[model samples]
Target chain A: MTAPLLRIENLSVEFGPRANPIRVVDDVSFEIEAGGSVGVVGESGSGKSMTSLSILRLVPEPPGRISGGRILFDGADLLALPRNQMPDIRGRDVAMIFQEPMSSLNPVMTIGDQIGEAILLHQDLNSAQRRKRVLELLRLVGIPDPAGRIDAYPHQFSGGMRQRVMIAMAVACNPRLLIADEPTTALDVTIQAQVLALLKDVRQRLGTAILLISHDLGIIADSCERVVVMYAGRVVEEGDVRSIFRNPAHPYTRALLKSIPRLDDERDRLYQIPGSVPLAGSVTQGCAFRARCPLRVETCAVDRPPLFAFGPSHKAACWVTAEAAQARSAAEASP
Target chain B: MARYIFWRLADSIPTVLLVLTLVFIAMRILPGDPAIAALGDNALPDQIAVFREKMGLNVPLWRQYLNFLHGVVTLDLGRSLISNTPVVNLLAHHLPYTIELTIAATLIGVTAGIPMGVLAATHRNRPADSAVRLYSLVGYAIPDFYLGALLLIVFSLNLGWFPINGGGDDFPSRMYHIVLPALTLAFLKSAFMGKLARTSLLEVFGKDYVRTARAKGAREGRVIYRHALRNAMLPLTTGLGMSLLATLSGSVAVELVFNRPGIGTLLISGISERDYAVIQGGVIVFALFVVVVNLMIDLLYIVVDPRIRVQ
Candidate 1:
């Protein structure tokens, strides 16, 4: 089989000094095939955003650093690449779209110039060519009157239009991988749907792989083929979206599924998790989700459960799933 | 933008008029009379009366005020009570000196202070940042005259690197003489600019657009100078406007210390000699100069930052 387009192995991001660091993204690993879409869903501060930032090496230094990780893109160790060569890889191979569209764009710069900037960095195009490409990209992103809006500043555009401009800039270079960090959380529902549809359309047309990071499961379910559920900085479950939603193995994943307000359900109160995720670095031993896990066993407190295979291409970090897998394997061997 | 400028100039009319009225009232209420000051106490009563009438000091206060207002409208500042030279000519001669000093000081402050501030903010918490912070603090703490005296003692008295007093006649000599005073004035203003730039740059660095620039694979230098600095300049421009006005008016102390013949010196000599016309003319001119500069800065704000243009 062909290798995955991007692979992250045992990646860990920490805050504070090396002597006493606070682990925020702890030993997480995932992969995205070429032109495949993967969604990372977790609550705020779950290190989902930091994981994506690590891929681009954009995490703020001093307070935050990648303590341990190997990010491989197209068989090249991105983490080991020289600092100066990193910029060449960033907008050329991978690009990112941020959450706050209004703030993500430079207010002083024209939309055309901002989009042209990315093109200029990676492409060897002259000014006229760059402007043409900028207009073309703006049009591709479904901006109205691309020619007229080209010279307008970010403030002149609405929140949705600004996001479209951001998307145009991100995809301008035709990068192989696009990492979006909660790209639509700041927009209204109608705008969010448009942005999601745009992302899907972009992926289909350009054949670019997407690593979508968001807290909204519905968004992930609608857009991504594979989903990785993160809990307290660890991947609690990984599987196809349909399988994960149908039979979630990890207790945290189950709780997350339940917490969503269903349209057909007549329940008076929406289901909520009992407690918040523990602060980073405070959970020293055992499972990070044990405090919030409803079915946590005593053994969960003594030993951390590695991801156990629950089914073909499905893994969950839970003792219950581990035991169930073990029992099924033993029964099959006896037969 | 043109309309905005017109409105600003219109709004400043009352301000200029108020300044003129206050200077007129203060000149009359002050103890010394220009006629007695110029003629001396030894003059006879009849001679004093003739001098006062000739200078129009013998007229009623209201009529004299109207005459002064009318003369100002016609661009006639009258003559100095003591020197009898045209006040306009005196102003024309001395105003250039003050303008030159202000421009030099502003140039020094902006060029040195902005770079220092950028250095400090980018390398925050390092030795360079600490050093710049301490330097700006010292700059703020020391008064302009005290710093001028220190510069004079070090560069003038000890090393003989610059002249201690007197603005020379020729351009080169004037420039040579102006350096020490300008440096003294620039030091304090630069400190202020440095602080303003550092804070403004720091705040812009934290903005989301800066992060977006970085994420776009922009080199660090381009991200800072191209993207961050422009946004940072809005606040810095406002600070600069205040600094320009302050330096224009604050030159008084520095001028006295350096013994330079600028507007500050002219105003001082006018006050001491009871030259009311010179004093009034100098104050009005100074007010007008400041108003015009501030108006220019306001116009510049729209150019530097497009967000303000819409407002």
Candidate 2:
């Protein structure tokens, strides 16, 4: 197979002193094939957002730094790219839509100008051409009366419409990859569905890969084809969306899936995970999720488990399940 | 917009009236009698009575107040008791000097101060930022009058770079004479503007939209100037209005030290001579300036920030 469009290998983002740093994103490894969708699902402080930010090198430094990473996008190592050249790649090749649509946009700038800015940065378009493109982008993102609303400030638009405008700007250059960091978290439930649908539609129309970061499993399940479940800065499980949802191997993943309330089950209280995620870099030598995992073993405390295969594309980072899967596979081969 | 201006103008009437009343009261409360000030302390009682009668001071206090109000409304400020010149002409002659000093000082302050602030903010916590901070600190610590004396001694006395006294003749010399006093006032004014702009720009730099602009692959200069600076201007506009008024007031002390004949010097002389007409006129003019400036700032708010409406 051809190389994936975006390959992130053992990316680590840290904060505080370098002598004893707090690693927010530790050894995060993932990839997105061209035009494919992947979701990084985790609770708050699980490093999913940092992981996405590291792709565009947008992490605020001094407090937070991408300490180590090989982010290879389109056969180039992004981590090694010069600071000045990075701008050329960002918004041109990899665009991002942030969580807060209300503040993400420049309050003083007109919507048309903001969207046109993205196109103007990369493309050699004149004022008229850029304006035309901006109008077209507005229409594509489902903003009504694109021409009339073009001159309106950010305060004029509602939350959902603002997100739509954000999406329109992100996709203006037809970027190869779109990193959406909880793009719909701030929207209403009904509006959330509309935004997610619009994202999917944009992905299809522009043929852009998406790295969706969200805490909500429902959002991930609805929008992404592949899922990477992260717990305390480490990926606990990653696989095809169907396999991971149906046969979750990591204890954290299983608990997360069970926590979702189902109308058919008729439960009195919605299931909740037993323990909160550990602070980053707190569990140095052991598994990050061991405190919260139901299937924790002695081995889990002493050594961190690597991603062990359960099938061709499904893997889980767990001492108990991964070892069991390994022994069962070996036994089947021997027989 | 017109309606907003009209209402603002209406609002200023009460303020002007209060200032006029305060000037009237303050003149009356002062120790020297108007007749004694105009004539002499040893004048005959009949002569004093004739002077009071002519000036309308012998009438009841209510009637005198009504006459004063009528004079204000009719723009009949009467002649200066000392100079015998019409108070309006005296003001018209000297008002230009104060206005020139204020405008020149403001121009210098904004032009110098904004760039200094931009530098300090962009290089926050760096050596350059520290240097700017230190400059502003020194600028604030020194009073403009003291600084004006130092400049006068250094540039005018020692070096003979400028003339020692007088408001200067012709447009060129006026520009020349304005430099020292304007600079003295501007020294403090720029310090204020620099501090204000630095704080405002620093706050805008931390906002989410600035980060968004950077994420859009905008050049650092573009992100700062196009996105951040415009937003920063809202607070800076308010600060500028206040600083302009401050500069106007500060010019008074600087004018005394420099011996330039401006409105402040005129008012001071009027106060010493107990020239009630000149004092009242000067106070009213200053009060009106305050009102007009505030109105202009309100108008500027609409231009700087689109969210604000005239209503």
Candidate 3:
């Protein structure tokens, strides 16, 4: 619709020597509508984190670089924005909370000073106003006794409470998009639920779109309306969460869903995908998942599959599955 | 915090006593007799005996040690055997010159080193970083005494910019004489500090909190100086404490090369003359200096790093 809040077009992140660099994130494209939630689910090294980092242009250079990309946020191409002006957009328009709540907050700084820093950067609030705002933010994030605990350091807070402080800092400026890279992966299960709920609540209250990255499909399913499934630096499947879960088109998506442990009576051995996802840049000229896909054909090895549409908004990058869907659709049209 | 300081001060008593004991033993165990060194070699046996008894050396080993400890506690360090001046007076005269030299060198080192370190870390792998690293390497490799000689030759002999020897009289002349020696020491200390700062800053830069600082859109300068530098300073401060002790010891050689009238010269002359009270007093002062410095560093830890602060 009306120019999705954030659009990533042909984004590619590479590392290593320039002559034969390793591409960590290759041709990833996604969109997040304003006030919407999207999840990127992938195994470690699947480029999901890199893709998210590229959105903010925060990827470590030298070793890591955004080799090619257009990150259009609102109407501006964030990739093309002047380096000096990036700070204006970062905490103000788009903020991020990392996976590590333990080490993410500055150890030497008090929680009030840290959360207040985010406000201080973008908002032109004086120190008193900033302190008042920080206290409010702390209360909003469910931190008890915002007054007494404001001066407490990161070490004094529990893991869950620290994450809440991080959340408070992230939302200090009311960013339009919040990129959470495995925000709950380091938390206890109960804490994870609480954090996820807090994130959802923050989104509802602030109307900030969320780009959630995680290796947990269940988390994606529960938190996201739409999901992008990435494998070996490429999106293998993307669609509304319901359709993708009900009728997963990509073989990797099917494998991921199958691997989820069920509470009901089931097989003695837990299901596992047959092979590990290939290392980024390891698969050069083929469908990245062809080596592990059970339904892979000759064409899958010679040529990479593009995202082929199966429905109005659902797409899958799989030679066999997309071709089968196309032929079935053609037969139905002929009838 | 006061309790921590009190305990820290109390903790140094044992260390100070251990140093005093070691000094006492070293004076006794070493070969030359204080009687012969203080008096003349041709002195009669009766005269030597009188000198030994006068100096309390005729007492038993345990008794001498107890007397030495008692004198130290009561601020009664004995007179220098050669100069016949009170050990406190000698220390009072020479200690200020050493302190002045040390403070000057330290000021130069910290001011030069930290900024170079920050620059090198921020521009890592660039020409600036390589240049700073090279400077640090050279600084570490070259001995301060040799560097002092070279500086004297170049700046004093060739350039005629500074005097070759002697601690100068008056504030301005003292500052002028200090420049070369301070530079020689500062070169090495700054190199040490720069290397430490660069390493510490580099490590802090990679920390998750630093990345978080960046994501919050803090300007580069703010991220580096405010966030990364403060975190990096804890290790640097510890390193600084170590380096300060090193500089203290290093000053002995530099002082000899420069021929400045400092505690180093006093100690050297004391050893040659076997001035037991002078040597013992000087060694105790050094030991106490070390204790106070280490104590200050621990207290500094509380100020710089909140994690180490007493709850």
Number of the top-ranking candidate, with DockQ as the measure: 3
What is candidate 1's lDDT per residue for B136-221, written digit by digit as tens? 99998999989989999999999999998987789999999999999988998889999888899999998888888888899888
Which residue pairs of candidate 3 clash? none
Cα lDDT, model 2, residue A89:
86
TM-scores vs. true structure, each candidate:
0.95, 0.96, 0.98
Q: Give the TM-score of candidate 1.
A: 0.95
Ten residues in sequence with the least summed lDDT for candidate 2 chain A: A272-281
Tens-place lDDT per residue, model 1, A1-335, is: 89999999999999998998899999999999999999999998889999999998998987999989799999998999988888888788899999999899999989999999999999999999999999999999999999999998999999999999999999999999999999999999999999999999999999999999999999999999999999888898999899899989899889999989989999999999998879988876899999888788898998888998877878999997778768988999998
Task: Tell me the tens digit of each residue's lDDT in model 2 across B22-100.
Answer: 8788778878788888787789999999978877898889898889889878877889988889898898999999999
Ranking according to DockQ, highest score first: 3, 1, 2
Better by lDDT, candidate 2 or 1: 1
Show the colliding residue pairs in model 1. Answer: none
Q: Residue B260 of candidate 2: its Cα lDDT?
A: 88
Query: Which runs in model 2 stand beyond 4 Å of their true positions?
Result: A330-335, B1-6, B28-33, B36-40, B60-63
Select the stronger candidate by DockQ from 1 and 2.
1
| TM-score for chain A as predicted in candidate 2 | 0.98
Q: What is the TM-score of candidate 2? A: 0.96
Candidate 3 lDDT by residue in tens digits, B1-311: 77876787889888878888888898788777878877778989999999988889888899999998888888889998877898999998889888888889989999999999999999999999999999999999999999999999999999999999989999999999899989999999999999999999999988999989989999999999999999999999998898888888888888899899998888888878778788888887788878878988988988998877746
Poorly placed runs, candidate 1 (over 4 Å): A325-335, B28-65
